[model samples]
Target chain A: MKPMLAALVLLASLGVPLLAVAADPLASPGWPIAQNRFLTGKTYVFDDRVQVIVPRDAEDSTAVPGFVRVQGIPDVQQIMVFAELNPIPMIVQFWPHRLEPNIGFRFKVQQATPVRAAALGADGIWYIGGAWVNAAGGGCSAPSIASADADWAERLGEVHSRIWNRGDEGRRLRLTVMHPMDTGLAAGIPKFYLEELVLVDDADKHLGRVEVHASVAENPTLTFDLRTGGSVRIQGADNNGNRMLGEVE
Target chain B: MMPRLNALLGFYALLYGSFAAALDYQLQPREIAAGVYIFEGRQEHFTRHNGGNIVNTGFVITDAGVVVIDTGPSRLYGEQMRKAIATVTDQPPVQVFITHHHPDHFLGNQAFADVPICALPLTQKIIARDADALLDNMYRAAGAWMEGTEAVAPNCRAEAGKLTVGERRLSVLAVAGHSGDEASDLMVYDHRSGTLFAGDIVFHGRAATTPHANIQVWLQVLRDLERQQPQILVPGHGPTATDSRAIRETAAYLEWLDTTLREAAAAGLDMAEALELEIPERFKSLAVIDEEFERSVFHLFPAIDQEVLHGGAGNGTR
Candidate 1:
């Protein structure tokens, strides 16, 4: 019985340290973990032959990091990513996959978060890669052009989309909207936000939707995947009785 | 495993803390030149506040009227510029010249609609298509900074070409590559003082931010401006640099950027590696150099590489 008691005490002692460690909220997770969630809906898969490149230390633009080679994509159609909370959360997504397996673009990052890149391969698989940015400030929530709200109201229906045809059944489409997509965080003259609901549809079918927080950038430019030669349409409506429409060519 | 978790937690704490402290820095406008003024816009280091100082608008008080060059960021700012001008001059500006089509430079044009606004033909097209977006950006940006100010699209419009205002003869040079329809030029050739307002074409202090910039054409334009050798050169930003030395300094910075980027491209350096390089010593004193310099370099390197790859002459128009 005495030996049993000692064993129980020992077990309790070991368990106490584990509990202490678990209770510490400040513990670090070694590998960079993305706080942003992976979007699951229609999957876009592409070839791994392409490479995604950006600045390593974005803050210190002088330090150029190496290009991250993307693999496992079948046929790259649209390669892009979006900051869920950036002024323009749709960071960048290229359409009609180019022949050169690699492309580069420079973007203003706001804070340290996981940056996810989605690639739609020729095989129609949506593959994603993510990286952590040390960027701190977000540009989407910042002030937009002063006359943005009024102009957005006037030209809200002027929707335009351009599609680039890549040979061999591959295509890219770039869609832009004139919406003030106020994130409900800004304080204006009368102390109100330009609240609105925006939607993207392909042939009257909903592809993706965003519940825009105040962080979406002004004049949101979204580039996404549509099979080459596929016809699409986009529409947007604001809570303030504003609406915009666009047709893909 | 514990160490990795600790590191991750440390990073998160730092990030969240910094984000919470991302307050809007006040944008201060300073009179950088004699007849030239610059509204150095606010730059939010961490948050979603990205709009900084827009175009540098200045006026030369000629005997007949004032020659206003470029407009502010929005129609509201344009109104502010007008009010600012009213304080200095009795008569309103008769002729306005757009230095470029960038929103900050020309978006506020509507306030000056009554005046004969002029710009390159390409600038007109860009403004027509992008005016709404420009105004949206201005409003969103101003709401984040100053109180009660709102962004308004400019109604004033103009076309690109050569024009004369009173005794001041101006030439609109179609300089592309920075933006789709960017027009830089030699405005107001004052025979009296011999000052040439080289808007964005001549960046006196450190390198200018070139996100939508065409490095090759921008460099060539700098060389062309240097060839002209105006006595007093007023840049788009920074203090008015007197003499040809400012022109030389601007040229030297471009040359250095060209050389450095060329070497990096040849070395097969990626964007990240290229950005890591140390900036030259000459630009240390300039404000926001550390923050904006790398972005400038990253933009120029690939742009220069693409220009070389196309086998196009570095000095091609636009």
Candidate 2:
């Protein structure tokens, strides 16, 4: 071996510290770094039970539908979604307080990348699942249709939400809010997006909470499965401190 | 010395051959009227084979100079279009009127830099703001054909009134809705030849792209154009026609698209489900209809869904 290689091998034998190599299931260059950042100092396993469902190809990079459903896990507390190669890699972090471990939302994909979902179970284990999404890219930086309108600010924080009862499949609530969700990557646009959103039952009990990022699409849509059919209120605040409030029956 | 001369000749031949093969649009201008000629483009989408030349471009030779309408998709196309105009008429081009701010229609503005390139005031603004992104899209779709191509903003504004270019009295109309909210589609009517250049407002056989379209308003604009009733019509795409068939065809397709999207939204179909919906048999003959339909769905669905599902109130004000 070369002298440099011999020296490195000798250092390794002497227990020199080096970055641990991670075996990423999707074989993405961004996965190791993203994993380290999002799940810092936390151990994770590639679990098939932690399901991440997304289209094989994003027909529209600006709003690609994605869902995460955790099965075979009895006690799931937290869930996080990541698009490993997006400029903003962490798409969302959810806390299912009284709701099921299922979420459906649309997010931007800057390029073809690995989309991952990690469910933190009551056992303190991070179970991860992921899929590859092919894309034409530029989702994060493209100016949204809302940004072009002169009066988009007048209608800002407008929320439209609906509930559907699927009986055996459980209840679903879909909420859409009007916001630019700008990543600020485009020229002459500032970063603005919903920072946190919480769903509350009629009794003011927290059903679920989601921390959103700019990686979400403009006019973000968040769908969730409810444990029971009842009226709920959504309260949110954007990075610019704009209040997004709505109620759905 | 003889050997060196032969090598030099070989080098020139190779250079000529490569240039000929790579950037040749093979533009053929067909005269539709007296002093009015059109270089009809192919019906295919932007590809390396077609070099983004999928839109019709034409010119009118007036007593004083040549008035060009709509440059093609790339810098090479614009350069070649200038050369082709030279072959047809000796008059230097005095003015260039861009039909709309779409990349295919105005990426060639660089070729007419010396001429006063004109467009609607709004079209100029939209082009200036969105030109970079649109040009980037052209590069992605057309590849190497866009080499050295840059988005050149229109230099002058074509106001909504009669313009006397040389001896030709042309009526310039500023219309909207065919292109999106921020665009103003420009149509020019030649009083002498009785020919109306209906920009993207009229697509003959090809499907209309709706990345920036408001269909209801677009239909109303079509009705306004039909009332003018020019003897000859030069559509933005497809063959030049002497009748109003192009206008009717464009309106019919847009009407169908509008109804389809509304019904799909009313039925609460998701974007993916709407994309999978079938197209009628009549529209199957239109070139690139499927791709355009999907693109329209992507552009129009989310807004339509909100309108149809929740009575058009985008939530509530803060």
Q: How large is the C-alpha RMSD of every model relative to the true structure? A: 14.2, 7.7
For candidate 1, report its TM-score. Answer: 0.52
Candidate 2 per-residue lDDT, tens place, A1-249, comes to 599677777766877522223367788889768876887767677889988877666758999877788999987899999998999998999999888898877899999999999999998878899989888798999998889999999879988888767667777777888899999888999999989999999998889999999999998877788896679999999998889899998
Q: For residues A1-249, could you state the per-residue lDDT of candidate 1 as single tens digits? A: 899667667766876322111111212232112122333334332223444444434542111232334555555565555544344445444443323223333344455444456666676655655455554354334445533555545655455456555455355444445544444434562212223323344445444443333333344443343442456555565556556666666
**Candidates, DockQ:** 0.14, 0.14
Stretches of candidate 1 off by over 4 Å are A1-112, A115-249, B1-55, B132-142, B145-164, B167-186, B303-318
Clash numbers, per candidate: 80, 1
Q: What TM-score would each prediction reach against the true structure?
A: 0.52, 0.73
| lDDT of the candidates, in the order given | 0.52, 0.85
The reply for model 2, stretches above 4 Å from the true place, is A1-81, A93-104, A114-138, A141-158, A164-172, A178-211, A224-228, A235-245, B1-20, B163-169, B227-229, B266-273, B305-311, B314-318
Model 2 chain B worst lDDT run, 10 consecutive residues: B309-318
Poorest lDDT segment (10 consecutive residues) of candidate 1 chain B: B42-51
